[model samples]
Target: MAFSSGDSGGSMADINVTPLIDVLLVLLIIFIVTAPAMTMRVPIDLPQKSVNPPPPSNDPPPPIRLRVDANGQVFVNNNPVATRQVEANLLNLLPPAMQDGQAVEPADQPTLELDIDRDASYETLTTVLAAAKNIGMEKVAFLDNM
Candidate 1:
């Protein structure tokens, strides 16, 4: 608090801004100290463009499209498959190593595109998803069949 220097020796009504300035300066110092740390980047190993990279030898395999209709009928590549045989049918489409219970390499993993009817039962959807998961088919995608 500051006292008035006028004839009236009462306390000044004006705000005491010295403390506010001090606090602002302290905050400014804290931000200055932390600014560099905040912007410290994580070093990433980005792939560099090669001057003469070799052309890819072969095209990737076409994605397997699986369709599930409103009646819960499952189809693999447009061929109707029984609900009990869905897993086997999918396994047949995969590479032999996958069918033989071997860990699949990422490059050899086949993508499964699921085209599901909106009116399809949740039970049917879950069954399809469970089969894919159990078979270690990681690249399953939902197709907008509308």
Candidate 2:
């Protein structure tokens, strides 16, 4: 009987996982090496908050409009003016109420609206922006046709 037990005929086989473990380790190493290279770094500066509140206003604000046509012509409050004269006109046209040396009053800054044609060049738009900056008009906005 003991000799007959050795006559069993079924063969046993097992799958080896060494190759799969090696492939997984290689992939993990590749990802770890390339991850930092694929990422980008950017620097930004954030603003701080101010605790003091703005002063109160007693009078209605004035409106200043500057328009740029497709031909690069400039207009101040609907009056056609040259590009060279924009700075001077903006400085001169500042409301008298905003003049310096008055009492501690709320800013009488005029609301500046820029109307630019769709075909206007960037040079023209930037020139107007520089002029507005030179004249100390801080509250400038763009006018869009609805």
- Give lDDT per model, in order: 0.84, 0.75
**Per-residue accuracy of model 2 over 83-134 as CA lDDT, tens digit each:** 9888888877777644442332335577788988999888988888888766
Model 2 ranges with Cα > 4 A deviation: 1-56, 97-106
Candidate 1 local Cα displacement, residue 21, angstroms = 56
TM, every model: 0.58, 0.56
Q: Any runs in candidate 1 off by more than 4 Å, and if so which?
A: 1-59
Consecutive 10-residue window with the lowest summed lDDT within model 2: 97-106
Reference-based TM-score, model 2: 0.56
